[model samples]
Target: MPRRSRKPARPTACPCGTGLPYAECCGPFHTGAAKAPTAEALMRSRYSAFAVGDESYLLRTWHPGTRPERLGLGDDRRWTGLEILEVTGGSPLHTTGTVRFRADYADAEGPGSQAERSAFERIGPDWYYTDARHFTP
Candidate 1:
């Protein structure tokens, strides 16, 4: 019997609401073809990762100090969109930065949103997510 060959599916539009397809937007970053140059970009890619349940990409982009031993995504939750509210630093020359954004989703309970101010650090031309302070409203 011949073994079946598994092929990767084509990437669709980015869930971060960039309007561009995933291959043109965050896919490069997620696949290591490119790196996020700013905190805001990293935040967007991270959100996209969550929507697709890409735990490996999420952990790889997270700061080692804060990254958990493992990551799990709830199948019951469906991520819808992302809105970037604000950004500070995280530029090409900056070493640290913050991004404030809202991620919309729906779960077993109902539709809801998460607002967070995420911190990022630039280490040798790469941006890594450090932590976040979640907000309620």
Candidate 2:
């Protein structure tokens, strides 16, 4: 029997709910091909990274001042959705901003959601996630 070569799977829609393909959406940011231009975009990319378990992207995009020494994303949890509720500042001309969102997920315990107001800071042309105030809903 002859061996058949398999092609790579195509990228799917972004997990951030942007209705766009992953390559045109968060893939660039994940690959360092581009930087997120706004706070909301950074937030979306961050959520997408979580969905795909890209720890390096998450750590690299996190602000050094507040970034933890390490991050542990267990394989047991599956991120299901992202909803952006609010955005402030984070413009092409602004250096600071915030994004409020709800990221839903499922684990052994069942389904749950995490709502947060995350702060971001821009250095030169790049946006970095600073910290977040988590909330219960």
Candidate 3:
């Protein structure tokens, strides 16, 4: 008898719009298996966290000075997509950076989007989300 090889499972698309598998793109960052290398990466991971309602990961990567004591990650909204509009600094050598983005969502009311230019700071080797300057949605 001949041996047969099992096919690998297909990967699910990451909600961050990276066109990559969730496991490869944001799963490691969410699970603490790996850290985001750049500020934009962190922002992408944060958006993914929101999409999946991983509040712990969101708080963990937030700047301690700004992190909320607790989160209410309810099921009222379903995060649909992310759009990275702009990026500044956020390199390995820079301590600060900004990422402008729009996060799309759908709720009982209807589909909507939130746009903001977010700031990030690097403390040691890890990047943390600082805050955002909101734009009219």
Candidate 4:
């Protein structure tokens, strides 16, 4: 897909490491227009959560117990890009899924980057991030 500029008319054009637009990208997933079918979709939604400060979405997608009671929105690093490295099958009803990704952004610390390998689980058609190894996710 062609890279989208963060233009206003295109709310989904956020190069926020989402790998897709706010509209066709995580927007649909966030607004209940769709459900993530794989670990890759979950990871992209997580990236979108960070982009728009939709901590609620993040929390909602997180598995219970590990789910935070609250999420404080604050200044955020400007996101640049998302590079999906890999994805693995979880299961039919519920399975263990894995995804690897690389993200770029700018922060007070300076231009920075994150590479993560994340895990997900599908429970009754809902996909949630189970754990994020500091190594990448």
* lDDT of model 3 at position 101: 94
Global lDDT scores for all candidate models = 0.87, 0.90, 0.90, 0.74
Candidate 2's displacement at residue 104, Å, is 0.6
Worst 10 residues of 3 by lDDT: 3-12
TM-score of each: 0.90, 0.90, 0.90, 0.79
Clashing pairs in model 3, backbone N/Cα/C closer than 3 A: none
Error of 3 at 88 (Å): 0.7
- lDDT by residue for model 4 (57-112), tens: 88899989577888776665766677888777754544778887788888888887
Report the alpha-carbon TM-score of model 2 versus the true structure.
Answer: 0.90
Model 1 pairs in collision: none
- Model 1 TM-score on a 0 to 1 scale: 0.90
Give me the runs in candidate 3 sitting further than 4 Å from their true place.
Answer: 1-11
Ranking by lDDT: 3, 2, 1, 4
Query: After TM-score superposition, what is the CA distance of residue 68 in candidate 4 from its true location, in Å?
Result: 1.2
Candidate 4 positional error at 78, Å: 2.0
RMSD of each: 3.2, 4.1, 7.3, 6.4
Q: After superposition, how far is residue 44 of candidate 4 from its true place, in Å?
A: 0.6
List candidate 2 stretches off by more than 4 Å: 1-11
